[model samples]
Target: MNAPRKLWLWHVPLILLSAIMLLPLWWMVVAAFDPMHALIGGHLTLWPVTWNLKNFVAAWRSQPFGRYYVNSIATTIGIVTLQILTSSLAAYALAFLTFRGKRIIWGMTLLAMMIPVQAIFIPDYLILSQLNWINTYQALILPFAASAFGIFWLHQAFRNVPRALVEAMMMDGASPLTILWQLILPNTRPAVITLAVLNTVFHYGYLFWPLLVTNTAAYRVLPLGLSYFVAQQSGFMQWNLMMAAVLMTVLPMMVLFALAQRYLRAGVMHYGIRG
Candidate 1:
């Protein structure tokens, strides 16, 4: 085959694969507007002859999606804020502080990462229940405030800070706390933002633990509220509304990731470079 023809042939399969991957999302956009057709129905509607905004409106009206949205935002933001604070402080200690049993403390922190989140669910539940936090926002945010992954990530980033820079700060009569807050933290902006964005994306879709912990719709996040569409009634199975709900739930984090793609890449690169 000629060069152009060979190139076309190679591109053909890629084009087909792209279409295959996008088919569901395309159908979702179509389905979100077509209220008459259910998502799993035999007759697939390639395009809606009539585009109506009712499905989106109805999905919100059917349940308090707005409240669920607010809850999700609050939980995600709260969790990220606390994680950044705690993880940065802890990572600073692990990276710079010299103290008794420091290695053992760091070892325990690493060990925490090895323990699967699911395994701790029962204990976490018991603790939250004892605190009467099962149906509260604290139940959603407090437990995840200190993330092992965030600590480890920041630890690596903090290591990249030159020792001379810290010493310079110290020689200038700056305290260790001042060095950490003023020098190290500012230099680690990319790593911090990357972890915050990653954590928000992760916790946004955290369904199992949230569902287990929060029973009331008042404190329910988007994932739990989206599931309500499945559990409530046969009519709610209409794919259009469900897809609309899914898009509504997913779009924020998707946009966030898209915007911060470079920072995330830089964080990973810095980790490798320092290692």
Candidate 2:
């Protein structure tokens, strides 16, 4: 009926939704430190009754998580870096350059985005197998280096850049690469950082492709490692240990988001306003 009441009505729903979403994360933190017998006995609480660090130690020692962490970090960084580079270049060309069949190319990119990766898995696997790239970093990283969504996102951001600025740079006899590196990239900093953050977050948790590609624990990434850890718990589920592994697997991405939140927010704002 009143403004404050209406505001409360909206805020109440959102607050409830937020709590619902965060419940699992809270459960994870609680379970990660709580003793296994307490967890199994339904003694779970919002706070840890008895804090134990053994779960973390056991989870870490149980598997080659150290190697898994290294592989995940390397593959994620490689994929994000290459995706940003290739996507930005393609976006710039599509947004700024005038060429024959440009529309067709753009259309194709959109079409590619429409097709899910699962649809092309067989072909991709065969190709990688032919190249003898399975069970290697190349298998993990190369297939995902080019992102259709990244190209589309950056294309929208690139379009927001003024044509006059590009023309002025060209008038100064700057090469296309120079113009892209200096003018376009600097102006699109927020978008670039946001894309990087998003890519990092997505690839950090990527499980399906890595599972399909690699067989051995040598090249196993975090997600696969977590799954393997779960599988090793044959008779009884080690809830506390599993939760510890999850927290460990998730911590880096959480830190990454915290560090990049500013840029990510700015980028979202920029895209929203520009659109």
Candidate 3:
């Protein structure tokens, strides 16, 4: 078959656009390893003048990165786990169950998605205070355990399951719970993984709520720890150290995306199945 001539033109602009989007990320990687002099001089080198692991080592030692790392991992996992459970359950019920006010409830849930997080911050802080959960993991993890986007995305994926299959399960004496676990979940792996990736990354950078809720250093996550690093230092920013700190903070998510990029892309498609 002859190639479509216009296809090449379509991709030419897309390639250029992709390069433009990637330039900042490329700069960040280069800047992270540049020598202090090169960094100060603002030279854009494709490769570092001298390669050293000192930035990473210094970043790790400059603060309690070990503890912060552990806390961040734990908190992110906790939130993602709860989100999967709650969002899946809510999505299953919304997608398959017939009940009074189902549409109304679904509408409300979708409406909740439109509300800004900033609007709820005061109420969330007040509730945490009333519960005396300040400086506790509960304060950090509980409120965000269920994401509107996750529920909405999973609901869409669940909607793609054939209605005939659900009817067959019902005729076979399988309850909704059984159908959900055996029928829906097995087919929605991509959507689940995509939501998990998004939820994990979202939690990774979660800062404002943590800063307001956590009063002590021991509970600090990477974002808060980086803030503390900035505050503890004096004079003009130590460009090298700050870049090193930024690299340390961003490394885990980068490693995860690198390892799971294929799965993440598949999941994104699944999540968008209905859309």
Across 1-275, the per-residue lDDT of candidate 3 in tens digits comes to 98886777888889999999988677666656766633355555666667676776776788998889888998999999999999999999999888999989899888989897778899899989999999888988999888787789989889889989998999999988899999999988778888888778889998887899997888999999999988877876665666677888898999988977898888866555553
Better structure of 2 and 3 per lDDT: 2
Candidates sorted by TM-score, best first: 2, 1, 3
TM-score (C-alpha) between model 2 and the true structure: 0.92
- Model 3 steric clash pairs: none
Worst 10 residues of 2 by lDDT: 35-44
lDDT of 1 by residue, 1-275 (tens): 54664676788899999999999888878877776756446775888867888888988898899999999999999999999999998998899878899889888888998897798899899999999888999999999988887788899989989988988887899987799889998998888877887788889889988998998889999999999876776644567778878778877987898999899898757664542
Tell me the lDDT of candidate 2: 0.90
Candidate 1 colliding pairs: 31-240, 32-240
Off by over 4 Å in 2: 1-14, 36-40, 272-275
Better of 1 and 2 by lDDT: 2
Query: If scored against the real structure, what TM-score would every candidate get?
Result: 0.89, 0.92, 0.86
lDDT of candidate 2 over 124-213, digit per residue (tens):
999999999999999999988998888999999888799999999899999889999999999999999988887888888989999999
Judged by lDDT relative to the true structure, which candidate is superior, 1 or 3?
A: 1
Alpha-carbon deviation at 235 in model 1, angstroms: 7.3
